[model samples]
Target: MAPWLQLLLLLGLLPGAAPAPNEPRAAGAQAWELASPELLEPARFALEMYNRGRAARTRAALRVVRGRVRRAGRGSLYSLKATLVEPPCNDPTVCQLPVSKKTLLCSFEVLNELGKHMLLRRDCGPVDTKITDDKSETFSSFLPLLNKDPLSQDFSVKMASIFKDFVTTYNRTYDTKEARWRMSVFANNMVRAQKIQALDRGTARYGVTKFSDLTEEEFRTIYLNPLLKEEPGKKMRLAQSIPDLPPPEWDWRSKGAVTKVKDQGMCGSCWAFSVTGNVEGQWFLKRGALLSLSEQELLDCDKVDKACLGGLPSSAYSAIRTLGGLETEDDYSYRGHLQTCSFSAVKAKVYINDSVELSQNEQKLAAWLAKKGPISVAINAFGMQFYRHGISHPLRPLCSPWLIDHAVLLVGYGNRSATPFWAIKNSWGTDWGEEGYYYLHRGSGACGVNIMASSAVVD
Candidate 1:
């Protein structure tokens, strides 16, 4: 017989070879085996070395073990009693071999060398298994990393449901162990944030969805970049004297000065939303009817702005002033992308006479919001990305007063627990942050709320 035929017969691949009626099969012989000798030979040799406690002597031997184990599938390997060596080493650099679970013997040095070599491999299946096992051992380990408190069963179930919904809604794909682990971390953070909110310290805030999953860079790019634009050559004064008496607690949403919350999607066109919101409020106050003005108009027609890349509310105001006005959402509609200008002045429903920049004094801002309508403001919204609800006075370290990176509307102000806060409206839709509104620390220039504040005077 040919060597290939002999090998196939040995692997039980040729068929027709059956045991006698009275005879029995080998104790652990598998019905199915790998057809490739190239893979099987190395795997058998590696297993022999592992049994002899010499598997960690070389990198090549370790690679063979990992490859065969992965190719055979994790279930098959586990069934064979292939598990991590006992008494894990303290050092991270040391490797642990998957020895037969029944075997009690272990060699630390061999395991260490094997681990080091395994770490170097691009596709180390054993490392993947380790990560999987670690993830399974802890129910969302990232939760404890954020907060040491034990989570309730209800919270866990809710979080799991939320995670499932998020993955389904976003069409998220976790193709690898690392990806799944990351999703788990995000889910854990979401659950923790919810728990923090449930305590109702009244100061702790929580977000609606898994905003924690987004990195700072991703958040900045998607939600906070709209305010990044070159400033006008002439600096505008930001402070002006106002009455000493505190403004009344006000909410423009109640007064019908604010429109329904809008979403910018992935576009960095928050400048457009801010501009339109301010204009919408001004239009409502002047015309006695609320109108959803076109953010798409500015996104498409504003030559001075960078559309989705970034822009400024002030620049958007300038575009509106030049173009003679903006159309209604029903006419132009928001596409959430850069497109050719489809704006028509004939369809214009609102026009801005001019835009005025406000003083940096929080008191003055509060007064202006009370006296006027919604005003657009640029702010450092780094922490607002995860904001759910509450007085969002983010820690100083999480945000900087000088780094103004987002445009939002100042709708109202009030005192909560003797801590005054600015009622700011966001463009991330009604699902986020207090129905698209957030409260920030009123004074001390929190998150640059008092800086670069402006409002359009509409006709």
Candidate 2:
């Protein structure tokens, strides 16, 4: 026998040292009582290389057994008996053992110790050993690894069901690259959602249903492109200096100053939505009546601004003012495409005298919002593509303040659990965010919310 093989037999890791297959089993013996003989060659090679100080070769041999153990699952550990020549005891002098029978240590414990030793010795690179643990314990502990709290089995089932529903809901065809991409995105977003929820930052909870499958480009093209234009050289009018007593909390939705959330679909028409939303709030505040204005009017008639290709809310306001006025949604419905001007001064329902740009200071912005109605503003919406809610101020380095690319309606502000937030209404329909709204971390200039704050002057 090879010297390494003899050493393995002494350690009781080989089946040759165990009783014959026909021998009576001991009471409470596990099902995998016999280790497979195939494991001995690699084990002996690994030990031999380790003793020889060939770290690389030792790692290679250990990897072979590790792969087998992983493939065999944790249940196979019971069959792997390790003979401990030096038994673990509080007092070595008090320990006694029969000279004929070797002491068998728990295989799972021995394997774990071996893995730790290999890691400490740099024989193997760092690895998540928990992934190879007992299946039951592994699955139970998987959530924590992802920085999520333990989820109920029903929640897990529901998450799986949501993934299936997303495929059908988005009308995605299965088995294609796009389908596979969507699945990957959905799974990633689910994990992200759970991690966000675990943060307990606010009362909001994130989910993987709505915009999870859409790529950043797709999201920007559909919802954010309208605000992608360079800042126009025209100077914005300034509002009269108002008192600085901001309200404790305010929501235009509660006061009926905000309109129902509208979807831009595949059109880059958020510019029109933002303008119309601001006008809606202004009109409601001035006339004490709500009006659902036409976004299609802007798309068709606003030649100064691009319809679906993308435009700015400031430009949309300019187009509306240039066309003399804007019509109601019932008169000129949203087609989500560019068309020729169908402007009619006779059918115009509302008109803004002018629009004023607010200061970039968040405190001043908040004060203005408390006194005024909803404001049309542009923001850096990079991380907002999969935003599941919870004062969305991403800590990612890529979310720069200079990347302002999306236009939305700043409707209100409030603090939840002492965390202040800006209530902004998006144009991606009522199914997104807190019913078609997102709360941004207030007073931090989060996502460039303080960059381009502006409101229309309704008379």
Candidate 3:
């Protein structure tokens, strides 16, 4: 065995032998009743949850050997022993291998209540069945990426398993060359994510996201705006002080000031979405009617700022005022690309009086947001590519305030178990981080939350 393989085995990181990190810990068996209909349902529930968390290709068929159930408060606890059998073949055209026949004996405990089944604990050990060395004709071309292991510490085995999971989660299908390159990129990104996770001061979890397969440059060019880092030319007028202090926490979404989370698509139009979200909230609080404003209108009409390429909210506010107010999202729907000026003054629904820059102090920014509305701001977006959830507070050097890239909206501020965070709305749709929102560390000006803060002044 290789030295690295020996080390992995010593660390107990062998493939297929180790339970998933989020799975329940292994425990000894307890006395229980015999197999029953109630117990079978809970066992099936546990199996379903397990399968859902795994890659579609790795899914196994369940054959119950024994089962038992006991009553718990408002739910039932179940114990089950079963065999997990691997599928016969991956492709119908090439069926050279004889079912792979490999299997495992797993002991599972599940809790079921009101149609919700939760797997409590599972302990699985390899069965006597084993796979032959034969490879299918259809699968041989991508053999390096599809190798299976019942229990081994080989790097190839682990890499194959993880890469498969990532592709399945994102529903990605790539040719051989693309798949090889993406696997390399995925490996590199996971390392970066681990570093970010270790350096984070807050409770953020960083790992394989939807963007795991993409290289840093690809992610930046497609999703981030380079123009945000540029200076806004001249400084805008400073915001005035509010009459009352803000509460400890605030969220514009609950108050109906913010619109539904929208996607910016593949364009670098995060700047436009950020500005629109801020203005949307501003218009709602002032006019008492929530309206989804047009981001495409700004993309087409904002002469001072570039469309799809990148733009600044300060210049975008001026553009909104230049276009004789702004039109609704329905009037000028978004196409996620640069287009000719099709904006109409007669279709205008909401207008802004002017815009103001906020103080760099987070306390004051929160105060202004509480009184005004969501604030449009730019962030470094350094660790944002693979950011999953929790209060993301990367190290200052990693996510510097001076060099910002992506634009976002500050919709709310609150605490996550004593770690304060700013709920930021991104333009990447609800399927992304925290339901289209990024919770950044607050109070310390993490990720340039205090830098480049500004908003439209709706009448």
Candidate 4:
């Protein structure tokens, strides 16, 4: 026999030799195996690094670890019983892996060193393990990092999958599906914008934004004042009158038996709501009745343009006065609508000593609301979507905090012996805060008083 035939015969006769040349490959060929034994340690390390670097001061630690990962090239370069991704992203790299329970993913990223600055791009692949999905339904979580693609294919598909999972988790965590969906959309857009910025060497501009994003001053200059100039009928103002008594003292206006209304979401009608709330309270004080009134009228009809979605109480009061006084909550109703402003017989309810701060006004207001029902009060500095709930102040020195803007009704006040604090209601809805209410120091006058317009719910 020929030498080649002799060698082939010997190989075929060995224990694992196949009977035929066309035989299928065995399970051993396609079987899944650990990508690397080192995955566990590297993953943990990356997570720790991410947490440490979450703040500005610890960013240097991240840079140092980034350097280490750079040395771990993607190859059969195994060491100490673990497979680690090799760096110099001529291939994929991973960092900042999430803590989850459902799917196990190994992350990789590549960075382009630009002297003192570095551009980071990342990719991740599923590891086929039973783990938690941390990305599920979280509106603000699972944001994809910027992509610096040296290759033609985009990582957008994977990014989107992660985003979807984030939304899923967020929806599960947050009871409000609509709010979660909207936040998801906002987060995704923000991520995309960040990616664009990274791609352009960390410098790019976002185009125009939604009208709601504009500031009160910006809105006035761009829209409100102009509209008022062209359509004078839209501009409403209360005629100045001689005061029966001095303007009510801050303490008097601030004092009230604590109650809160849920914060309505950003609809650019805060002016209307604030003014309406004040009106509602004053009306009740004057006529001894309670009725919800029309906030929608200000939202729809107050076309003065200064503050649509972002309005002020002064403007809403002007609109009411311009339209020859607002009717009782029972007459026009407090539905959120925008009906045509019509002339009404109702006259503005006035509070005597509007600015006078009677002694122990806080105690008086508390007693009044405890006996009556709810009293309205004005707050300042509420300028975010989160205010739609009972938001804890990010800062402290709880002595005198004024994070609330606009005005809200104070229905009742109470305190537990264990927790010597007053409970207050908000208008942002019931799911917010400690069951649609916030607790503050009893005598601090943070929210216990303020002349929210009173109401008269006449038939």
lDDT of each: 0.61, 0.61, 0.74, 0.36
lDDT (Cα) of model 2: 0.61
Candidate 3 accuracy as lDDT? 0.74
Off by over 4 Å in 4: 1-263, 281-288, 300-307, 312-361, 364-373, 380-404, 418-422, 445-459
- Which candidate, 3 or 4, would have the higher lDDT against the true structure? 3
Give the number of the best model, judged by TM-score.
Answer: 3
Best candidate according to lDDT: 3
Worst 10 residues of 1 by lDDT: 112-121
In candidate 2, what are the lDDT values of residues 40-90, reduced to their tens digit? 543443333222321221111122232244321111211222322211233
Q: Candidate 1 lDDT (Cα, whole model)?
A: 0.61
Once superposed on the true structure, which residue ranges of model 2 sit more than 4 Å away at CA? 1-162, 168-178, 188-205, 226-229
RMSD of 4: 25.2
Comparing 2 with 3 on lDDT, the higher-scoring candidate is 3
TM values, all candidates: 0.62, 0.61, 0.67, 0.38
lDDT digits (tens) for residues 1-459 of candidate 1? 877556535533232222222232222322224334433433443333332321232212222122223321111221122222222233334444433222121111111111111111111124334433332333353343324336665665566556666666655654344344455566655654544344332384675454666543345555666335345412333434456555568888899998888999866788889889999999888999899888988988888776766787777888898999989999998887666788887898889887778877777777777777888887877446567677866544334566777888888888888987888888888867887787887787877777678888765
lDDT (0-100) at residue 152 of candidate 1?
Answer: 65
N/CA/C clash count, model 1: 5
